[model samples]
Structure formats: C-alpha cells, structure tokens
Target: MADIDVLRDVAPGVMPAYRALVASGELYSDAAQGMAAEKLQSLWVKLRGYDPQPKAAGQNGWVGKLLRRKQVDEAGEHPNGLYLVGEVGRGKSMLMDLFFAAADVPRKRRIHFHEFMQETHKRFHKIKADPAVSDPIPPLADMIAAEAALLCFDEFQVHDIVDAMILGRLFEALFERAVVVVATSNTLPDDLFKGKPGRDAFLPFIALIKKHLDVLVLEAARDYRRERVQGLRAWYVPANRYADAALEEVFGELTAGVPAGPESLYVSGRKVVVPLAANGVAWFDFSALCGVALGPGDYLALATHFSALLIDGIPRLSPDNFDEARRFVTLVDALYEHRVKLYASAAALPDELYKSGEGAAIFERTASRLVEMQSEEYMRLPHLT
Candidate 1:
C-alpha cells in the first residue's frame, strides 16, 4: 500500500488550492471543497520537491543502509495521489481541474476517463495485431507513464467486464512507475463494477484503488447541473419563430454564451458531424438528425459525448418520411436511456409529433418516452457518460 502522512500547516486558514474554485463562482461555498483543496496543496508541495529533512544512518551501519535503501525504493515506486468520489454535479471534477492546473509537475494530463479508456482499447487492439504480443497491458501502461507523470481523470466509472478486468494490471504498473493519478468519480471504489457478471474478478481493482490512492468524498448536497437548469423551459411547441428564439436562448443559458462549432465524431467507424457543439451540449437541425441514414449506434455515441441536445424544427412525421421517423425513434431511445437532456422545438406536442405517420403505432412508445423525458424527474437523472 502507498504510505500517507498527515500534513498540517502552521496557519489553519491558508488554502492555496481554493483560488480557482472561489473565482469560478459555479458552486456554493462549502467546507468539503476547502479541505480537499488543502490536501491537494500538500500533494503539490511534494511534487515540487519541497521535502526538507534528510535521513541519517544509526550505528548498525551497512545493514541499516541496505534496509533503508529497500524502503526508499519501494516508496519511490508506489503512487502518491488522490482519488475523489461524489454524486453527480458535486464539483468533484471541477476541483480536480483546479488542482491539475495549479500543479507544477513537468508532465501532466487531464482527460475524460471515458476517452482515456477508449484510447487504451485502441492501443491494445493495435498491439494485438502483432501475433507475438501476448500481453499488451504492461507496455501500454508503460507508454502512458512515459507520456504523463501526473494523470487527472474526470468521471471515472467501470461498467463493462473488459475495462474491469484490465484496470487492475494496468494501474499496478502505473503505480510501480510512480505515476500519480487524481480522479473524480460519481461512485465510490467499492461500488465500482458492483452488479456486473464477473464482479469477483473485478475486486482486485477496487483493492488497488484503496491501496494506492487517498479516497475522499465530496459532501456537497446539491446537483449543480440541475440547479442551473431548474424551472427553465425544456420543451417548445408550434415550431414558430418565437419557439426558435426560445430554444436559442435556452442554449445560451446552458452554455453561458459559449460559441458553438462543428465537431466530427466516430461511431463504428462512421463519421457523424455535430453542427453546433459547446459546453457539453450539441445542437442539431431536424434534417441533420432524422433526415440522414443513421442508426442506434450513431445516436448512442451522440448520447455518450454530450450532456444535452438542442434539436430544432422537428416537423410532424408522415408516411412519406417513414424512415426518418424510425431513425427519430431510435434517437430518442438512445438519448432517454443515457439520460441526455432534450430541448426541442417541435410542430406539436410529443403525442402529436407523429400522430398520422406510417409508423404511428410503433411510435406510440417513442412519444410516451419523449413525454417522460421532458419531466423534472428525467432532467434530474445523472448522465451515463
């Protein structure tokens, strides 16, 4: 297990790491974050080579020197970092971002945990193409350590057996190289991979987390995302100029007036163009979404990337565009399952969106889901990715 020593400064109120958190004004002031910032400040001091004491050997001489060398080696090889866990929108990720920006390490990287796992999967696949490579995890972990001495991850989660099985070995190697990690997650270490099929096989990974990292829970009671959009209009009707303007205004409120730009995303090797994306939300026209030849895979990928979607000009479905209506159904299912917030300007209500379409009977379920998704309950659901 990695060793930890409690550190206390002479002045109890000096908190260097809370600067960003206070400046952002994104959350209410809380003692939980202030304490976390102090811990992070201690880590930063160590990473900056701020140790003051030097060790001296006793009368045991060479024997004592050998024992001390072994201890030093072991301590040098193990990770010394922080693992932060909390519920959704408690500002765990936000705090990690502040700490990462303030850390003075020569090589550090902060990334979404899902994107890191995706890259890891890609690396393993590429290595496996060479039949001689039996186990690729060690080399991949080495590559990761070579790239970054400090790794900061956002929204870490484990749902699938593939990720669950490999994490133990991959992280063991990382810790052995003294690669520090700071991660934020919605779930605690013990609860990761809790209900999956090969859960027993995943236990060692949880153990590794406890051994190598200091786990802290953010105790903030509020969900900041919900607070931000609470009581705001979610659905617009009639597809008129006023509804269009309202949709745009809602987008601005959610995104804080950030400029939207196009992004190309890949799903099953298929390229999907998101025309307007900013601040974790994407905006799309009806034709760009339902009018194209797309499937559930593409829609699922969209849900994975964005927290919310603003779709404009959804027309009343008809028999002529039955295929588009089918795609729309698939899209709604993906978004609903992932709890991606939906903001739309449609020709009519959810029940009336496809009243007389070729697939009207099949779309009853879709309309029902659309109606449910606009509720306060659905908006409060946490995002899967």
Candidate 2:
C-alpha cells in the first residue's frame, strides 16, 4: 500500500478528520503530514527568485535566507502573510492547501473568493441592521479574527465594484488583529483593482496589501488542468430522447432530501428558480441564482440545492437573445464558482454559436467562457482532422 494508504489504515479514526479536512479543502495533505511549513517556506523563496523549480545549489541563497526569516516570523507572535499569483491550475490552490494545513494555528478557515466576499457582505448587512451591534467595525473584525487566526482564500480575483470598495477595509481590520492571510489568484495585486474608473480611491488599500503581505508570482504558464487530462477524451452528452430524464436524475441527486418550493429553487441569497414557459419546458435565470449581491450564507444554503444542471434552451443566441446570453454567462460563472458539473444543450457547438455579426466580440467572449465552462481542454481541442 502507498504511504498515505498505510497512514490511513494505521490510524483510521484520526485520519478520518484529517482526510475529511483535506477533502473539504479546509486543510492541505502536506500540512496534515507535517511537510507544508518547510515546503511552503521553500516554495515562497523560489517564487521570490522567479524560479518555479529552485535548484539544490541555491537552497541556501539570499531568497532562502529571507524565506527562513518569514517562516520564523510566521511561527512567532506576528503572523506572516503570503499571496500566490498565477494562471489557473498552476498548483496555486494546492500550495495554499498545503500551507493552510501545515500552519500550527488553532483557528483557520479556507474559503473560495466568491463565497468569502458573499459571506462578508451578508455579515455586513446583518450588523448594519442590529442596534445592539455596538461598534460594528471592531466587533465584526474581532468575530472574523476569533473564527480564524489564518484565512486562506482561493481564486482571489476582484472584478466588481462592491468587492473593490470594502476589500481594503476588511483586510485592514483583519491585519490589524494580526490575522495571517494566504490567498491564491489568477491576477497580480497591481492588476487587481485596475481598469475601474474610480480605482484611484482604492490606492490606500493597495498600499496596505503591499505593506502587510509578501507577494509571490508563480509564472509557469503551463495549465495544470490541461496537464492532468492531456490524453483523456472530452465528456459530451448530446441532447436526445433520454437527455431530459438523465438531466432530471442528475438534478434529483443534487437536490435530494431538500424541500421543494417553486419549480425554481433559490440557493444562497441568489435565486435558482426554474422559470417554466407556457409549453412547460423548464428554464432558469443565472443572474438571479448566483451574483455578487448574495453572500456566503446564501451559498451555504445553496450547497444542498443541485449538484448538476441540465438546461436545454441554449442555442445560437442573437442580439435579440442578449438576455439569454447574459443568463448563460451567469450560469457559467456559478458552475465554475461552485465546481458543479453541468450538461448543457446548445443548438450548435460554441464555435458555431456566433456565425457572423457586428456583435461578434461579445459573442466570442461569451462563447469562449461557455467552452471553458464545458471543459478547459475544449479550448485547445484540435479541429477534426
């Protein structure tokens, strides 16, 4: 048996919690095995030197020395912060899991970026309404601090105005209480708050991040997701006679044991109601289901909703069908965020979705996003020989 299997068999009870934590991605396996503290320190040093794979000879170099200092400080009273930036699937999340698992801290929580922002917004609104709240800011700050000494966030990207506005203050409060933050993102810190018309107002927050966290770039361009399934055939389910029944089965499995309300269901604060037309065909509104307006509490509520989706109305949308396209984008984002499996039916493949139009750019981006939603490998699939 493998070492992990052996470890599991030898200590089944203790291993169960560790396995559960790792499986839930709240803890990293390396950390559970007591290797992340050292590995993370080395990884941090290598990242600083622009080396994805550091050489044995350079293990004791200046970067290495700096890493040792950071590790020592992190292990001490002053919690250290780490920021990992890279393209999707370059092991950023995995590395974060390792670091989070390895940290000896008592209180820790790892949450997806979308879910975290949603939760923060939910809590903010709750505190706003309560008169007995008594100094909302400090109490709120203390609450997060008490709940988590270390906060590890995955898929950390800032594209919306609401998130941009409060992220600084939120981080500032957490940092003030010496909460260590480890985050992974596809974009660099400088590129994060960019392009917004009034982004200048967020400059102080940018400075605060630079001051509090040690930023590291994982520059390897190779897509780890691609590497994992280079030779695997794409999974495709064509719309057919049995498609609806199969889709319903998948949906039933996802929503099993949950109470039924409207044919449409609401997950998280976001609505997942299935709007039916006069013909009785089931459809859904993505924007209402998963948007930044909702919070983590909403997602927690949604977790029990549906694990898979089957939407049959997708086709080559036109300018007249902009609403449909927008809804599709929303569904794509929700599925990606929740890591839910999906089987969709479009009148044509993504490439053929936009045949010709002046609005081709919008269609192209949407189509690309849809393709990505289906399978990242589909983006690189070779045309039929």
Candidate 3:
C-alpha cells in the first residue's frame, strides 16, 4: 500500500476537479449535487493509506491467527464513510460516479446495488457448498473487503428479504476489516426494508450504517434526469427519415462518452443478443425483438438489464399480424413495469398501431402506457431492476 502522505500528494481533490469540469462545460453546476460532491470529497481525503488487506498490519512477528484477528479487531482504524440519500432523479447516481472516479484508493469498486446483491448471494451459496468452510459470512466479508477497500454502490436498495437478511452480518464484518463504503440510495437509512417481513431483524444493519457512515440528504428543485427524459422526442408516428434521425440523436445523447458495442444476455439458458449497447442503454430493431418468437421472460430480461431502450422499427398492426402486436404489448408492459425510458420510430402512433388486432382491446392499455411513459411524471420514476 502507498503511504498516506504519498497518496495525498498525488491525488487531485474531488471538489476542485469537479469545478474544473463545470467550468469547462463538461458538467453543469448545481448546488444540491455539489453539496453531495463536497461530502464525498471529505471521505476521499479520509480514505488515504487506509488499507483493507488482511495483512495490512504486517505478519512479521506474529504471522498466524493473531495477525488475522488483529485485522478484524481494528475496525476503528479508518474514517467513517458516506451514505447519500435523495430522490430518484436528483443526481444521486451521478454524484456516486464522481466520488468513485476521484477516489484514489486501492481495490475500489463501483457497481449497481441490485447486481452486487445478486453476486453476493451467489458467492454465499458457493461458500456454503464448500464442505471445508464452516462459517461463510466472515470469509465472504474478508474476501470482499480485500477486493474493494472502498466500495461505492449506486441505487442501494433492499427489495428482497433474502438480501435483507444477509446484508447485516456481511456489512458488519466488512466494516470491521476497514472497508470504506459509499452508497447512494433513494430511501433513507432508517426507511430501508421498512414494512417488509423480518424488518425488525434488519434494524441493526440500519444502526450500523448510521454509526459508520455520514448520512447526507440531497435535494434539488429541478429533477435533472426527469428533464432529460422529458426532452426526449419519443413515440413518433408514421416512421420516416425524421424519426430515424431523431432516434439516432437520442442514442447519441444517452450514450455520449460511453462506447457503443454489442452485448448478449442469457435468460433461462437462452441467448438474447443486443445489436447495440452502451452503458445501460440498449438499441434494438423491432424485427429483432417482436418479429422473433420471444416470451415475456425474454422481454423482462431485456427490461431488467437496460435503463433505456430504443427500438428502431414497428410496422402497423391488425388482425393480420396479431402475434407481433401481442408481443409488442408484452414488451411495453415489461418496459413500463421496470420504468425503462423508451424511444422508438413506429409506423403509427401507439393508439392507432394495433386498433383492429384480435387483442387490440388489451393493446389499448399498452398504448395508454406508451403515451403515459413519455410524460415527465412517468420519466421521473426510478428504473427498477
């Protein structure tokens, strides 16, 4: 590990770098977002030379069980981390990204909270399956702490009871090993897992968070993400060159700075190849999706992975093509349920798209949702995975 002073000399402070970006017009300046950034800057400064390695205290003289025990005992050695709370579109994620990028610590990681929990459960199962290991939680915590001394989680949430039960012990042990956690959540720490079954058992985890992390509530009059979603020119009628050009622009805007590439996701042992993807935005053609025989599970998987979706084509529908129209309805339902942003160039407006289909009555709800999705209110709802 680098010495504390050495890291301090080399690491550019977060606030100045952020202001520089704003001055250069790379990021718009906002007080609420900047406040959270300042708090992150404080944590950034405090994390220097704080090592999460099991042998951080050295194994020179006492190189066995004593050394390992010493690592867990020194939980008070590092500065407290930060927990940022805010509304869905209030730039909580953006601030998390900024802090993580500017953090000059070794073995740091930034990941979506849902994805992390999924992997955590998987890791726990693997550890449990190993007959050699008696207790899995401590080892799992040690492994995670060793990998990411500084962990940043975006959209920290507790939707599943299984995850809720595991987090308390896992995070408690991780904290003891000098792992610094910075997380962004839409819910306040006290409010997490509230009203869920077994929530009383989850109380200690909330207390542990309050003890180890400085909680900051971020608020802004303008919802930046909602504005971005509202500005979108979505749901065009009678697909033409104009709609094509508009969708291309939307793709460019959403995927700016992120490289465009192909991605493949597996659902139920089946492969779904995304023609183009960058960041959490996916671009697909209507033929590639509804034209092919895909079920609700496939659509759900796509909706789960992508925060925003841009479909390029949709032919007008009737009883002649009820199958595709039904598929379209399923796709829209998945997208709506997940709060995914949608952009498409279709042959007709959503209302007129499938008016005469066998299931067009059901399609009406989809059309209504399609129109509702474009509204600012709908756009402000957070994307659910």
Candidate 4:
C-alpha cells in the first residue's frame, strides 16, 4: 500500500485529466460529470493504503484476536464509495470506466451488472448443489472480496427475484470484508426492484446501498448515444446491397471500429450464437433470430445482454412461414419491452413485413412496435441491459 501523498502525486486527479480530454474534443464535457469524477479521484486517494486482507492464520491468539476485532471495527470507516445514476448515454458508464482505469487499486474489477449477476447465480447454484454447505452467501462474498477490493458495476439493474433475495446478504458480507463498490445505473436505489414480485424482500438491499454509497445524479442533458444516431436511418427497406452497406457502416461507427466476432449466449442451458457482436451491440441474420426455433425466454435473455441489435434480411411472411413470423413477433416484443434499440434491413417496411398470414393480426402489433422503436422517443428510452 502506497502512502496517500504518494498516490496523490502519481495520480493528479480524474477531473483534470477529464477536462484535458474534453478540451481535446475526445470526450463531451459536463460539470456534473466532473464533480463525480473528482469524488472518484478522492476515493482513489483514500483507497491507496487500504487493504482488505484477513489476519494471518497464526493470529488466532488472544492478543491477535483483540487486534483483529479492532481492525474489523475500523474497516467500515475506510471510505464511502459512489453510486452514479443517470439516463442512458449520459456518460455514467464511460465516466466509471475512466475512474476504474485511473484508480491504482491492486485488486479491482469492472463488469457489466447483468454479467456479474449471471456469474453470481452460477456460483450460488454450484455451491448450493453441495447439501453440506448450509450458507452460500458468505462464501461467495469471501471469494469476491479476496479477488476484488474494488468492484465497479456498469448498467446496474435487478430484475430477477432470486438475485434480489440474495443481494442483501451477499453485499452485507462484502461490506463487512471491506470490499468497496462503485456502480452506474439508470434507476435509483429505491426503484431498483420496482414492480417485481416479492419486491418487499428487496428493500433491505436498497437500504444497504443508501447506507454505504454516496449517491450522485449525473444529470447530463445530452443523450450522447441518441445524438450519434439522431439523423441516421434506423430502419431500412428493400433489403439490398445499399441497405446492407449502410447497416455495416452504422454498426462499425457505433462500435467505434471494434471488429465484430461470434458471440454465444447460454439460455436455459442451450447455446445461442450471435453471428456478429461488438461492444454491446449484436448482429444476426434474420434466420438466426426468427427463422429458427426460439421462444420468448431466449429473446428476453438476449434483451438483457445487448444495448442494440441489428438484423439482416428480414423476409416477407405468409401462412406458409407463420411459425417464423410468430417468433419474430416474440423477438420484437422482448426487445421493445427492454427498450433495446433496433436496426434492421427488412424485405419491406414494418407494415408490409407480414401479410395474408394466420399470425398477421398479432404481427400488426409487432409492426407498430417496430415503427415506435425507430422513433427518436423510443431510441431515447434507457436500455435495460
């Protein structure tokens, strides 16, 4: 652990660096963001000499036990971390990324909130399989604490009751172990488990968050992402080489030239491969999403993992391919519910995508949603994933 002054000397502050970057026209400047970054920088300083290691094995003696108790008593006083809340594209995740990168903490991790919860669920299930392990939360928290003294979560959200039920216990253990957490979310702590069944049981977790973190609202008025897509076409008709080229260009621009590659997701123990993915955007052929056998669950899972989806070659549908058309409807419903931005090169306009089909009645609703999704209003809605 370096001395506080040494840490300060090594890292001047996040705001100064942030200002320089904004001045270089590399980042959008916001005063609210600067305040949050400054606070994160202060936290970085506080974390310099902070260590989360447990006492040595030989320190079980009475004097060592007394010293350990004192250490435990002082752990909570280490530092209060940050909880940043804002609308989508308000730069919450980007600023947190900058903070995580600039911080010199020895044990730190940055992960998407959904991915973190997915890993947590997997670990819990694995540990619970052993009947002898009565309590899994503490062990899980210990495992996380041993690896990351600082845990930064991006796009923080809670949708599953199982995750909600365990978070209080898991986080309590982590806080006791002096594991600091910084997270960015579109929702406030109080509204995290809103409208969910068994949400009453999740209130304690919300209270835990309020007690441990400094809640900051990043009220940046600009939606940077929507701005990037404002004038660009979101929907393309007559799926042709021109539309194909436009989709490719938009995908590349949104992902900042990151090469797209194959991505697979496990939904209910079945692997669903994405043909192309970069950053948090996924791309797929029409058959990959709708022409194949799939259900609402798979679409819901996809909605939870991606910010935007681009589908290519959506064909016109009739009774002969009603099943595929039905699946497409389900996929659109899921994406719309999660407020995921959509880009597609379809055989025709949304209203003309399905006609003279047994499923055409419901496809009308899907068509309506497709139109709404392309609107600036829908694009401005925060993505749940």
* Per-model RMSD to reference: 7.8, 13.0, 5.4, 5.3
**Highest lDDT: which candidate?**
4
The pairs that clash in candidate 2 are 118-295, 118-296, 119-296, 264-273, 264-274, 268-298, 269-298
Report how far residue 317 has shifted in candidate 1, in Å. Answer: 1.4
Clashing pairs in 3: none
Candidate 3 lDDT, tens digit per residue, 264-338? 886666788999997578999898989898999999988877878999878888878888888989999999999
Following a full C-alpha superposition, what root-mean-square deviation does model 1 have from the true structure?
A: 7.8
Q: Residue 17: error of model 4 in Å?
A: 5.5
How well does each candidate superpose onto the true structure, as a TM-score? 0.82, 0.54, 0.84, 0.84
Clashing pairs for model 4 are: none
Task: Please provide, for model 2 over 289-334, each residue's C-alpha lDDT reduced to its tens digit, 9 standing for 90 to 100.
Answer: 4323544444333432333344653556566656555545555555
Two-way TM-score contest, 2 vs 3, winner: 3
Q: In model 4, which regions exceed 4 Å deviation?
A: 1-17, 48-51, 54-76, 195-200, 256-261
State the local distance difference test value for candidate 3.
0.78
Local distance difference test, each candidate: 0.75, 0.53, 0.78, 0.80
TM-score of 3: 0.84
Q: Would you list the rank order by lDDT, best first? A: 4, 3, 1, 2
